[model samples]
Target: MRARALVPGVPALLPSYASLDDPVAPLRAACLSAVGELGPRVRVVASGPSGRRVGAALAEAVGAVVVDADETGTLVVGNGSATRTEKAPGHLDERAAGFDAALRASFDHIDLALADELWADVTCLVGLPPLADGDVRYDDAPYGVQYWVAVWG
Candidate 1:
């Protein structure tokens, strides 16, 4: 399976929800660039309908099509935590940084309880193929949210 990309489920990534001056312009650019590499037919894996919409918007931005079957590549949408700082979406949680750090190291074993408390959206990440150091295209905690955009062939 050619897994093309991994993006965060950030609502701001969607054009419909975009602001006059995008707060995540750089992040959006990165996401589009990554999605463009996924070829024409892409399969989207997300936690819910909202996430699916974000994925679809991203695919559209890159002139890619979201497919349910016979996809050329897979796009997994998820993120680490929303409670990394005081101004974070979920506000600061003492355990947020550690949880996100562990996820960055490896998405294999996760603490469900901690994830919930930290407002992490990692359900779609579990059991996914491992990402190599070189495969990581974007890795940061911008806006106190841990987001990654990695690709694998």
Candidate 2:
């Protein structure tokens, strides 16, 4: 399964996405112009601890789906290694587990740094999804563990 998220730093956003299967690339590329940024890569918690990595950790983990990344925005997740699970601006009670692979952040072991310039306004993404049962994804059937890391615009 594949998920795509849109942390659109702009108003007229397009289809932002995070995917697991190979079919997600085209959909992601198609919305680049409209969204102004590309998606970053994260990992699935269910995939394992070592695989749960990502870029733009600060923004990816907390920022809203449509918040501005400029001015009051925080680029703490900037192209750095220590920011694998950086928290966003308004996060007050984030836990170690919550920041690393919580939600859908852990999916594909992300290495996409901000400097990579995959896209313009987009941030990070992963191939994992958090199960509704409050557990990490373990199945590789596309919908299992890759749900949290990816979402759609």
RMSD values, in order shown = 1.3, 15.7
TM-scores for the candidates: 0.94, 0.17
lDDT of 1 by residue, 1-153 (tens): 565688999999887888999988888878888888889998999999988999999998888899999998888899899898898989999888888888888889989888988888899999766666427878888888889888776
Model 2, residue 34: C-alpha shift (Å): 19
lDDT (Cα) of model 2: 0.26
Runs of candidate 2 exceeding 4 Å displacement: 1-7, 13-107, 120-153
Encode model 2's per-residue lDDT on 1-153: one tens digit a residue. Answer: 223332212111112334345443432232232122223332222122212222232234433232333222211111112222234221222232233343333334543443122221113334323234222112121211111222232
Q: Candidate 1 has what TM-score? A: 0.94
In model 2, the Cα lDDT at residue 75 comes to 18
lDDT of each: 0.86, 0.26
